[model samples]
Target: MGQLERATEATLARGARLVHAHPRTLASVVALSLACFGAAAYGIAQTAPDASDLPRRLVTEIVAHEDLPSQLEALAGHELQLYRSEQTRAGDGAESLLARMGLVDAEAAAFVRRDPLARKLIEGRAGKLVRAAATPAGQLEELTARYAPANADLAGTHFDRLSITRGADGRFTARIATVPLATSVRLGSGTIRSSLFAASDESGIPDAVAVQMAEAFSVDIDFHRELRRGDTFSVVYETLTADGEPITWNHAAGRMLAAEFVNKGEAYSAVWFKDESGRGGFYGLDGKSKRRAFLASPMEFSRVTSGFAMRMHPILNQWRAHKGVDYGAPSGTPVRAVAQGIVKFAGRQNGYGNVVEVEHGNGKSTLYAHLSRIDVRQGQRIDQGVRVGAVGATGWATGPHLHFEFKVHGEQVNPLAIAKSSEAIELSPAERQRFAGVAQQIRGQLDAALTVGATVAE
Candidate 1:
């Protein structure tokens, strides 16, 4: 029929002829195959026995049932305590807060309103974690609230505990104590679809951690302008908790331990390291300090309302050169000093509104205009991140915004360019060896973070 079929048939014919020519040999081969199959059958029959031939045994035991009357009596004697937790909200009064926690004790509410220590629950800032133990009848038995301590210096390391308990005399007693906070490491990863905050929110990262991430990479990336869609980041940070519950106030996020940001397909990494002097800062895995002479932006994160370019002035309605970048944020937003410097001028000027001028060494000076209020006075030394003022619409501004300007020898220059060109400090030789170990550990953490990001992307 075809060349292939004809070839196959010829081969088969040759094979048949060979078989016929070696009839005795073929018979011997068949006998050996039969013998091997018989041996295999016999071995299988000997190894496997019938189910009925295998050993069999019957076992039985009696299970005793508990007496129902005795069980009911035990349960009746057990105290039925209900536990509930709620967060304090703004405008929450004693009655409202107790009601939210499913508590309905008039005496408890009256004590909360009258007692000085219990009044602290509703006073001051809100968002305190409140846990209450109540009876089956919805009467509050004990109440405890945890929040940031009154002392700002101890806010990061301790929390204020306000506890109220019902005494044997049917009276409520309240006490306040400061307790040390616990620290825990956390890992998070996200892909940028819109903004860093949005990504961080989707990844369940706290706002404080996101702010720290932005600040850690402030010198390398201008979060206001450089963030791109599809960019990804992985972060390792410390979270402070009170009695195992995460704290919510006082910027309770501990410190950013390590982070890796892939912006525009280029990856940047940072790790926190403390020197023997107990001074700590974020450094690249290569041991290069991330701190620069100047930060790219005065605010942690904000959108640019105006750039350094010529545009129609909102007040003048005519084309004029805009010397500084305008950051659009709510009024009273703290404006930080971009570099450590001495306050040269901290007063209002014509068309500049309330302003603070800082004289950084090397003929470099920076100005923050349209400030609602100035915190630093003239001739005061301020650190790079120290708050100089707050955003405002004072002077010639139309809306609330921070107008930031950088000057080189009395001439205005682009602040972003100047910050990017600033030199970065390198680790000392003595610290390099220790830093290498830290970097190695951080590198593994980053790799794990990358895997987490990839999983989230999927």
Candidate 2:
């Protein structure tokens, strides 16, 4: 029994010594075993009968190649004459339009002046592209022009195209038709570097679209004072094209479907919503109207020289409460109305210069002073953002600056405070539900745009 125990102990010690002597070899063996087991298990799990029943045996056959003649027909060659296009320049009259089109026909000129339809073709239409098709001898065959009238809704109607064609009998026939456009939604994002217009140009956004975006949020934010470097914006707007080509660069000038602007770390969003009555307006995600009772500032952009406070009057040379805030701007800068009101007084007032006072209901009145020109007349009803006058230093002693004041119940108040404190309109219950769906769709588009913008930035 003792000899057997000793022999077993010796055997265990010899095995341990062998493992310690060749640890690398032992590890390799274990690794190799694991690899083999894993391979076998994978092979067993992946094994399957051939689902496609096809022959495994190989067969060979020889085939002959046959040659055939070409079946393509030769195209007849002809000279390609492209229609020439030219933009009507400033001071362009009927003679200039005809001259640019390479047409010298006296009958065509007379037709333009005599016929009503022909007169509509060139009446007051400037800076628009006009295309003409002419013969090799400079004889005008046809003239075409497509344009949208001033303030026309692009979504509801396409551009009007007027085609004046000369028949083989030498008689001119004029016809007006709608040039259809293919509508599409485009997403764009830009970061403000120097100015909004400059940044928009760099981001490939049209100037008209940028202007609309500013107007969309003009009620809450003052673009001139609030815009900062690195402020970013993303918009999902509509674009129009004709024949798969862009018809106009300002295709998105009509309406903005969705817009987002992050200014000073605050994000403002607006989505367009149209009710059953076909009335549309920009609204927030929570279904609140973006339009307020008044805009943030009378001017689109400016710098405030003096805030509402008690200070020494430059003209009076005495200390007095400056009831109105002063905004320094260039002469002839357009001044907009704060809200819908009636022009209570328009003309020169004591120490106010050429001032315009708009009286809103509920004993609220707004005063715009120091104007070189007044566009609105007394007792005239005016809407918000309407240009009332121009900036000038008229009454009060100062440079070209606008003196603006707000009053409640015949007492003067700070215009900036009232503008910021006014409540925005809200949507109805039924409209809220509809706006929710619209907002969801806009959110999806905005998300996709953010992703694309991030990728582009990277």
Instruction: Give the candidate number with the greatest TM-score.
Output: 1
Give lDDT tens digits, candidate 1, residues 297-399: 9998888999999989999999999999999999999999999999999999999999999999999999999999999999999998999999999999999
lDDT of 2 by residue, 421-447 (tens): 888878878878888988999999988
Tell me which residue pairs clash in candidate 1: none
Each model's lDDT comes to 0.92, 0.80
Off by over 4 Å in 2: 1-84, 92-123, 133-141, 148-159, 166-174, 177-185, 239-252, 275-279, 299-323, 326-334, 341-344, 361-364, 372-401, 408-413, 451-458
TM-score of each: 0.80, 0.66
lDDT, candidate 1, at 411: 93
Error of 1 at 231 (Å): 1.2
The total number of steric clashes, by the backbone 3 Å criterion, in model 1 comes to 0
